[model samples]
Target: MNTRTGKVIVNQTITADGYSAGLDQTEEHPFGDDGGDGWGSSLHSWMFDAGEENRAEVDQINAASAVIMGRNMFGPVRGEWDRQWNGWWGDNPPFHAPVFVLTNHAREPQPMEGGTTYHFVTDGIESALKQARAAAGDGDVSIHGGATTINQYLAAGLVDELRLHIVPITLGAGVRVFDGVPPRKLEQVTARAASTVLHVTYRVLA
Candidate 1:
């Protein structure tokens, strides 16, 4: 949910208590394992080794024109690492299309070995969407989240669809996914329950 004027979709994992990011996402605690109280094993499995059914769903999600992420989610990794770090995934990333990263700091576009081009947007989400829509053409524009960024777009009623994976655990104190968003309704498009994850797809209904 980062584009108010254009088609925007949000995909994220949430806990029973509604936390998206675990407490403290610093370089050292990349996945926020201060005391291993977060969704450590479940998150890893869901993102990296989700079963064939989950993988197929992700593949369809990735077929969109562009992917968007927030600055915190794109922060430096492994102790003040250089921009060359690219991301957690090496060489060929899961996302094979253009990826838009929203940040206040500006940097040169980073192109990876695969077809992924990391375009840093210094302006706000709207600017990012304009470029994303142009790049996407007829495909959908997807918001690969961080809670704050998603809330911004949701407050403005920009999201076209939302694909949420609800894990069973609950982090009492952490980043809530739906914080600071205006009241809105979502029409459930699909609901699939897997052994490891509960997938709920919704079409934003204003």
Candidate 2:
């Protein structure tokens, strides 16, 4: 009953200062030290703990057939695939569909539980997007991000819909969303205010 076209979409959770991540992201600190102890507990508490409260957005994210994410969002690995790092998500990840990771380092496809397979793309964003769209079919293709990745798609004018889960806090100095993206007007489609976050959806006008 959830048949949808394969529209390229972006969904990100950012702070009030527009940062999706803070400085010093490591294997231990996925989101880095955002003026907190680490672990990004506050920035991502809505997904980790209070999932049901944000069920609508959560479901929307999960409904995607394929996902494309930056290397940082995939894990803390850098340079080459020197280490045996599958991803931050242990054996099973939240995304049950095929996930294409944007990285210069090439690695073999790593399959995980729940039908999720991680494909390492060494080409570029366009190549990764092409693969994602092919895998997505009639379902949506989600551009999962950590700011930098989304900026590339936004810069290339590829994204169709933008969904931002804006948290109440500010990071002061972190990797902000739309850091180098060119200006563009967004058509607001829907908005919902929850206890901790304000979810806003926009149609990216060409």
Candidate 3:
């Protein structure tokens, strides 16, 4: 397969200790022990709380033409598509473009409100990326979260740029970033400090 035309970018918010999420994730506690009562409440306070301080970065995340994410990040629906679970978001998700969800089970393309459409890919990560790149055209492709998902892409050298929003807290036991990924040098592009988080961008030099 040919390489994707657009840059494979990953944007995630991590704690100071490098944990993406806490243990025991559920539908109610989407972020687990990160301290949020529900979904992104803990790590994403930078966007919700700070508002204009990180507005540019917040906007960048949604500007992607297409997105790829782990199944777990999509929702808590496990195994087969047992129930009518669209996503954590309501009728319309934040992403206004196509979203490829990586999973082992097969599910038809789910079209939601707005321009967002969820495509379930059971083949593999590379297959999902291939589909997303095609959908994205010349626009960028964002690797939407869940540490396990991003780790697989990074380990396979599929990511081109890494944009991380680093918060000041730590989750001692939680889902971490770069668990099995090997060492790789990254070129620093920019590092700007905000009121609630430090926005750091890195280009995968390798």
Candidate 4:
């Protein structure tokens, strides 16, 4: 049977120690580690490896109509920065759909060069999800990361699918992915292994 419904898909990578974003992700140290030792290089390599079939998977994930992210994942650079920074991605961001950012502070909607529009949602995650679902239409609604945001939806059982890439490196101290998540059953939908990353996809069973 075919069913048209709003779905939240989370894409995230964490260290073996379970740190999602890393420590103190300031502008200077975007992925943390202060520039000396960081997972940015590995993370990018893992995501953009054209040879790997996972790149195609990522492309399909972004083919949806909308994306949702938390304010912190947007950037702390927005605080002291004068110019508007869309995201780490350049003018042609991969996400061509409307991207809703969850934030407490209100800001004007930013339309980027590509088809991506960053809409700030001060209302809350539920509001963001509603807007994203409407924008998505028949397509899926993806909940893009930064741990806290994903956890918010997860705790509420709002996510439909979760795609995680677990890297081998471990950061002894940093943010955790499933830090306080209550034990819940996740039905494994798919599992694959690439040269650098292990891709695991799960569907929330309960």
| List of clashing residue pairs for candidate 1 | none
Question: What are the TM-scores, per candidate, against the unseen true structure?
Answer: 0.86, 0.95, 0.96, 0.89
* Leading candidate by TM-score: 3
The reply for model 4, stretches above 4 Å from the true place, is: 1-3, 34-39, 49-53, 78-83
Report, for every candidate in turn, its global Cα lDDT versus the true structure: 0.76, 0.90, 0.91, 0.78
TM match of model 1 to true structure? 0.86
Q: Any residue pairs clashing in model 2, and if so which? A: none
TM-score, candidate number 4:
0.89
Per-residue CA lDDT of candidate 3, range 146-178, in tens? 889999999999999999999988879888888
Taking the tens digit of each residue's C-alpha lDDT, what string does model 2 give over 1-206? 85666889999998998988888887778788775656888888877688989998999999999999999888887898889988887899989999999999888999999999999999999999999998999989999997899999999999999999999899888788888998988999999998899999999997
CA deviation > 4 Å runs, candidate 1: 1-7, 33-40, 77-83
The TM-score obtained by model 2 is: 0.95
> Residue 99 of candidate 4: its Cα lDDT?
95
Candidate closer to the true structure by TM-score (higher is better), 2 or 3: 3
